[model samples]
Target: MSGEGNEPQAIRKLQPGKLVIASHNAGKVREIAALLEGRGLDVISAGDLDLPEPEETGTTFVMNAELKARAAADLSGLPALADDSGLCVDALGGDPGIFSARWGGENKDFNHAMGLVEDKLAAQPDAPRDAHFVCALALAWPDGHVEWFEGRVDGTLVWPPRGTKGHGYDPVFLPIGYDITFGEMDEPAKNEISHRGDAFRQMVAAVF
Candidate 1:
């Protein structure tokens, strides 16, 4: 922690040990944990540790993810990982990007959020349904070292959202070349090509 105003900091590597997943969302935590299952590190969540969620004042996914990860790491005195992801509809002007969770209202009811997206598209009637999901992952250390990675998956939005397996906007998202929505796919299948999976892969390659 003492090194400051010196040469550029080298990218830190994550050693196998107790790591914090800095998020309260159960679905996201589960997905990340599954991705890390084969790794040797023990994983825990910010929610499990009762760490207060930091306000996401960052404008981009990477910024927000770093914010959460650093906060958790500093508070818990352990290396922490955080993910910020969202659905961006091109027709909606990339809306619900960083505000994806807020679109779900107070309880984070994504069904309602999906409906809102549908309604917005309904009003347009002729706008393209092209959209994408972006995920940003950040790993932070208690000493303030940080790493960031980002991933995106392009797709189209469908009405009458299908399936109930995956969470968030998964039911309405049809990935390119896939007939089934993410919600219709199993965890392993979804993880094979999800935005979060992409980011996680990058982190694992560089860190673990």
Candidate 2:
């Protein structure tokens, strides 16, 4: 998928117009839309367009993000943005790095997945409880040009979970320098320090 010179050219700027968000997860789409608000671009999700969800065959976040972005761009004839994010645990040696969503099973039942996490950690009481959330953002053009950024926010795990504001593992991950889990923090506060937020800001600076 090389562009000119047998290499993909980096997109230095994104013109103000319509863009496709290559994701079907409603929570993810909402968060991304909120981030891009007031940026003079109309954002539409792949789900809204009834775009088929591509299989995420990549083993890493960046590769998966690029795969999704490119797939959406090709289908929509518009610049596309995609994010691949997950929680990595030090104790588990990153068991769920690329499989975070899979851990929730086909139904995407995160409550059961969280319980599994708690159960696994319980068996390793002496192990480190540290963990982090990682997010990789890819911006792809229909011509095969792509730009990407990755960000992480370190934190620790908490048993029994907490709060109900955020979804997925938010209720169990307590960010560094914070007394409350991500589930307890308001959207504005969480966005200011989230891995996705960090990656989005970098992408904005580089391409927008």
Candidate 3:
């Protein structure tokens, strides 16, 4: 099928060939690789390559994802997939959107990150404390072609991290109309409506 500008779709369908997942985070790699399993593709994490991680300096998720994917594709001479995701809080004026991981300063401590959220929302007199997780997925080819997909889940923030199953801000994020935080939900249940799932599904539609 023709893609934008009548360019042939950049990605070939998932097959037996190797595809690199450009992420050092094991959680992100597992989630994405699971989605691609049994679809006739061999999904490998960049970590498996022991390659140096590219710095994520882009301000937006798309740019960051593209940067990572292209860097991996160039390095490995294979198609690469990368994702950049974060929690965006409305009350904080969408703060911690791009810097969600480093919000607590340079410690990279998740507990510290979660603590910052509580502190930021403690004094909100009338704000909804609404938030969402945004995920952007990018696929890059060694030939310089690229494709992107995005997904999000609307939710609200709560005090006190609730569950230990999930990482990042999952413990405080309650999806719309749900009583439990993402941390409280099982992995299968959460993936069904997760931002990563949506974006990955989009990429699958494009390729497979």
Supply the TM-score for candidate 2: 0.94
lDDT of 3 by residue, 1-89 (tens): 21233344544554468899998778778878777877777888899998778888998988898999999999999989888899999
Task: Give the candidates in order of lDDT, highest first.
Answer: 1, 2, 3
Task: Give the residue spans of candidate 3 off by over 4 A.
Answer: 1-14, 104-107
List candidate 2 stretches off by more than 4 Å: 1-11
Which one wins by lDDT: 1 or 2?
Answer: 1
Clash pairs, candidate 2, are none
Model 1 clashing residue pairs (backbone):
none
Model 2 agreement with the true structure over 1-208: per-residue lDDT tens digits: 1112223244457899999999999888988999999899899999999999899999999999999999999999999999999999989989678788889999878888888888899999899999999999888889888888888999999988899987789999999999999999998899999999899887777766
Which 10-residue window of candidate 2 scores lowest in summed lDDT?
Answer: 1-10
Q: Least accurate stretch of 10 residues (summed lDDT) in model 1? A: 1-10
Higher-lDDT candidate of 2 and 3: 2
The Cα RMSD of model 2 versus the native structure comes to 3.0
